[model samples]
Target: MTDTDLDQSYSAVCEALAQVGEARAPMLLAMLCLSLMSRFERADQVLPLIANALAQSDEGDADGR
Candidate 1:
């Protein structure tokens, strides 16, 4: 898919997650990974997803819950 298509897909997923509310947001992270992986042919696309995951993971770690 093109970058535009990927952006649209990302937006749609974000909307869906918003509609579902906070309780389901964590599950969508996997979908984001899969969607981004499938949509992006370039290696650069993967970096953003990896970075986001790492950032979120760090946040969770820092929260100490």
Candidate 2:
């Protein structure tokens, strides 16, 4: 990837790390996986979309009584 692409990716990683409050490595890894999966469907381009889906699922599980 070019420097701009690398910078964008790094910025995304930092953003995810700050939002999720986790180690940067795992968040970065998750981004990579999501980006790859995004190839099949467009959802991978952004992390928040995946995170929202997961959060919604968590809420559903909590309310599934």
Candidate 3:
């Protein structure tokens, strides 16, 4: 997807989270991930993405950014 599409997707997620509120936010995200994962042809394609996201999350935690 293009950067513009990514921006739109990010905004959509933020909106969904806002609507669901804190209690169900994590569940909503997990559900969304599962829905997106179905579109992928293979686990191998998505495994690296999950790792990269975790790595980025770790870096964010390290710097407190």
Candidate 4:
């Protein structure tokens, strides 16, 4: 996906989470991750992306969460 496509997708996800509200937002996001990951043929390809995401996480927050 291009940068524009990514931005649009991010906006859509934010809107969706907003609509789902805080209580069920985590479930919604988790379901989205699973749904997207289901399309990958190998976990090996996806694991690194997860790691990269974690690596880019909030450094200021001492607790990993």
Top-scoring candidate (TM-score): 3
Each candidate's lDDT (Cα)?
A: 0.83, 0.75, 0.97, 0.91
> Which portions of model 1 miss their true places by more than 4 Å?
31-52, 55-65
Estimate, for each residue in 1-65, the C-alpha lDDT of model 1 and write its tens digit: 89999999889988989987899888776676676588788889788868997899999999994
Best by lDDT: 3
Question: For model 2, what is the alpha-carbon lDDT of residue 18?
Answer: 79
- Sort all candidates by lDDT, best to worst: 3, 4, 1, 2
Instruction: Please count the clashing residue pairs in each candidate, in the order shown.
Output: 0, 0, 0, 0
lDDT of 2 by residue, 1-65 (tens): 99999999889877777776765668667777766776765445556767987899999999993
lDDT of 4 by residue, 1-65 (tens): 99999999999999999999999999999999999999999999899989887776755355665
Off by over 4 Å in 2: 23-65
Model 4: residues with Cα > 4 Å off, grouped in runs: 58-60, 63-65
Clashes of 3: 0
TM-scores of the models, in the order given: 0.45, 0.37, 0.88, 0.82
Clashing pairs in 2: none
Quick one: ranking by TM-score, best first? 3, 4, 1, 2
Error of 4 at 21 (Å): 0.5
